[model samples]
Target: MYVAAKGGEKAIANAHRFLAEKRRGNPQLPEMSVEQIREQLGLAVDRVMAEGSLYDRNLAALAVKQAQGDLVEAAFLLRAYRTTLPRFSPSPVVDTGSMRVLRRISAAYKDLPGGQVLGPTYDYSHRLLDFSLMEPEAFAANVVYLVDKMIALPSRIPRLTEIVGSDDLVETPQEEPDQDPPVPDITEEPLEFPASRSARLQALARGDEGFLLGLAYSAQRGFGFQGHPFVGEIRMGYVPVEVELPGEDVKVRIGSILVTECTMLSRAEETGGCPFGFVQGYGLVFGANERKAMAMALVDRALRSRELGEEVRYPAQDEEYVLRHCDNVESSGFVQHLKLPHYVDFQAELVHVRRRDVKKSQGADDQGPSSVGSAGEG
Candidate 1:
């Protein structure tokens, strides 16, 4: 009689059609081009790049659109896309020290040979919202440009960390790590004892931005206080990528991508070392994620005492504490699982509790005369 509710399917199709139309908006109006999304929605793109662990801006922008502006979802999409792509060979490491940096700032030494240059940061910007963006035409400001400083950045190719041994400015290496696959692919392999920093950072880089922020916040609020962190360097720019020729000593440029690399030069607290020991904290992410990079750096330094021959006392100092919980898929699923229905079990528990309480009350009521006897007996 009510049309047998037959329009539900039609209604769903109509709703989807409406949503597509709404997402596109008026045909006469300026269509939201991927270029527009890339330029205007850059923060979203940056976030995607950071957690996605890939640096393609256009694809990141498209992900932002497909995700309906949800940055985390966009990042997940980007990462998913990256996972299915083919792998040819490992790329040659780019030297960050020689990098043509766009933004470089060092905290360890204010007047170090290369001075601090903050390029395109919202660090000092006022937190006020601009409603004038409502029209979208009133936003215009002068853009600045400058060039300076260089610091070496180790690449992922040949396990280059061996090139510069532990905190020692100079150390003799037995030999370079032979060209081969990374030792751990936690994505495919299970995590085991004595986790590597490379594996830890690999997980952290693709971790949930907000969760990392919270963990980093914990360190700042004194959950684990060792030393103050200075923005040693945060560089955002393209670096030439390379692929080594298999069975040959030659290396070729594969492509270039934007990245944010942060190195925190902080003083180690006097736990077991001299009053202060200089330590380095490193963070490398896909896009210009200064905050995440800086946070990761701080956490990185805190976790180094174990390797530095000092006792690891704090939770932040535990490699397992930091790395085990950094994954987005793992963490979010666990936290959100609490929202699943448990009401049926809860109701049974409630009924049992009420019955026990009523029986106890009835017994107590029957002991009314006993209450009077207790006063006299006392």
Candidate 2:
């Protein structure tokens, strides 16, 4: 048994070596670099950053490569790395209205103050794969030249919600009171039942994409409120981050980061003194993960059951249900842990079952033949 155990340890070491070799398959071909992944496979890096709750592109790319292109695993690796970093003061609240817009679109209105700018989207593209990507140089050259020739987008674009508010068609966001309420940080505190909006948003922001997408779909398909929702606006751009130093009234610009923001409008019920109108659900995440933002917006709206005076019958409407199960790291770890050795537990169960069976057999044998014959006669 000792020899077998030693052999198993050696086998595990050799398996890791084999995996490393396979990850770098061809020596003749150029080795895949972190820069290449960041530049070319940008969407994957964006997902890793969003789900990992960290916004470093280079680190996300490196994690992607290390995970052998498994996006969830890459996100897990990035999240693990994030836990080791020193904490700093939280950045000032982002002003999405002042974002330097690259891509902006509104489904609610065709013609708004700012024209819809479709930037770097695959929405209108044909689904067919282009084999020409095999020749990288030509494709890279054309893309670079096209980008160089393109005009810079306007620094500020009017949001669709702003336009809609002019006609008083939607309820505007409530202004802050004299005393700002304390916003709960889910990362620092253990999640409890009846989460605050801040905590809910934080949970949804880092949730697994597929899981959120599924819940969003289920909500839309009449499982939840089933209110008609329209994408009021979807914008992708870079927003400047600012941080206020200790004992200072002034704020300093940290850096800029690319983000995608979605605003969804849903049907609102008429209440006392308030006319029937539209309510908003908002979502924002690092990088250009539009689908995640959109799904998040939908789920966010669904989760407003109590505030919106809607029935909380569906899974999406339940705060504890969604927030508790949305984390990919927690779910994946528990599921994968099942593969660990269970021999001792199984052996214990085996012994108990055998003992129970022997007792039952002895009880049957102790029954007399006369008792068996009388039973048969009856």
Candidate 3:
């Protein structure tokens, strides 16, 4: 028989109140506004949006405030809120090649057609902390950007993959000529093992940044494919999202959203009289999350072991392992559930341990006197 513990309702309510109070510390200080979070803590907001699978910047900022800056909690809140929204229509696939060029770079080539533009990156910045940020004016002054002249960028930037493919040095991504399959939505259906490329990409898009980064590092450290990978191109900009109306021949542009896209190329084995060429792995995520996009591309390539005829010896290469464990919501729930009261379960385990110990004690007593007497006689 088991008994359950009771009387936590009031305590739980009080705990939530306490949390809220702590979250809004130093009430004398100006309250942090959602707009400030969206604009100032923009990177954090971007991460929450990417991991939550929600694209609303304002909502993500609100979640960040509500969660007291805990990114995982913020993402969880956003994901919960996303479920309540009504589904209207599915958006058409975005075209990355047509993205309004903000930042574009390619490690594979010296200079691409549009030229490498290093726009607003911390890549070469000094690591020393600037304590002057304690003053609001100093922070504002540091971030001021003055564009003296307006220069027209090319309408379209040619992809490095196309450049490499032109000389037959790399295999360009191509769809089957006879069939055009609709991409499966992971949110609509439960993720199955041996998931489609669409499902895999969806999972990687929302996966925890640190987890994906670690796996990508592991793959690079020889746990998986050891091919030298070159970042073909990384682009960050806004692209128009379009949706097709039911029973309509036309698709209308809904809006524009910022995104980061990465294309990674690796050497592929030459066979069947074909020249040695490169294979590509692609990643795209909301906002300017370069690390996430790069990690995603690496993991995406690692997960394609079966299709690419490579041995699946690494954890990243296992489709079931990656997809099943990548969701932050599911992982965080299981981990945080440890805080829930487990009195009944613990009590049952305690009783079982006591009973087993008593039996052991009784058996020891039964053999004790005879063993002691035999030892004394010897």
Residue 19 shift from truth in candidate 1, angstroms: 5.7
Provide the overall lDDT of each model, using Cα atoms, as 2-decimal numbers: 0.69, 0.85, 0.85
**Candidate 3 lDDT by residue in tens digits, 1-378:** 012245589996898899999999999999999999999899999999999999999999999999999998899999888889988888877887778878999988876778899887999999888788789887887775746553667777766655554666776765656866778878778888878898899999999998899988998888876678889899999888999998898899989999999998876534323344777777899998999999999999888766777777899888998888888877888777766687899999999999999999998798889897998899
| Clashing residue pairs for model 1 | 96-151, 96-153, 97-151, 97-152
In candidate 2, what residue range of length 10 has the lowest lDDT sum?
1-10
lDDT per residue for candidate 1 within 1-378, as digits (tens), equals: 011223479887988788788777779987788899999877778888877777789999998887778776677678778888887776765665555555666654465444455677887889799676665555543322332443443332121232234565322223656775565766667776577876777777887777677766776666664556666556776667888988999988877767778776655555555333456677888767778887787777667767766667677777887777777656655666556566898999999999999999999888898796998899
Global CA lDDT computed for model 1: 0.69
When sorted by TM-score, best at the front, the candidate numbers are 3, 2, 1
Off by over 4 Å in 3: 1-7, 147-150, 166-168, 175-179, 269-276, 351-378
Q: Candidate 3: deviation at residue 277, Å? A: 3.0
TM-scores across all candidates? Answer: 0.75, 0.87, 0.89
Clashing pairs in 2: none
- Minimum summed lDDT over a 10-residue window in model 3 is located at 267-276
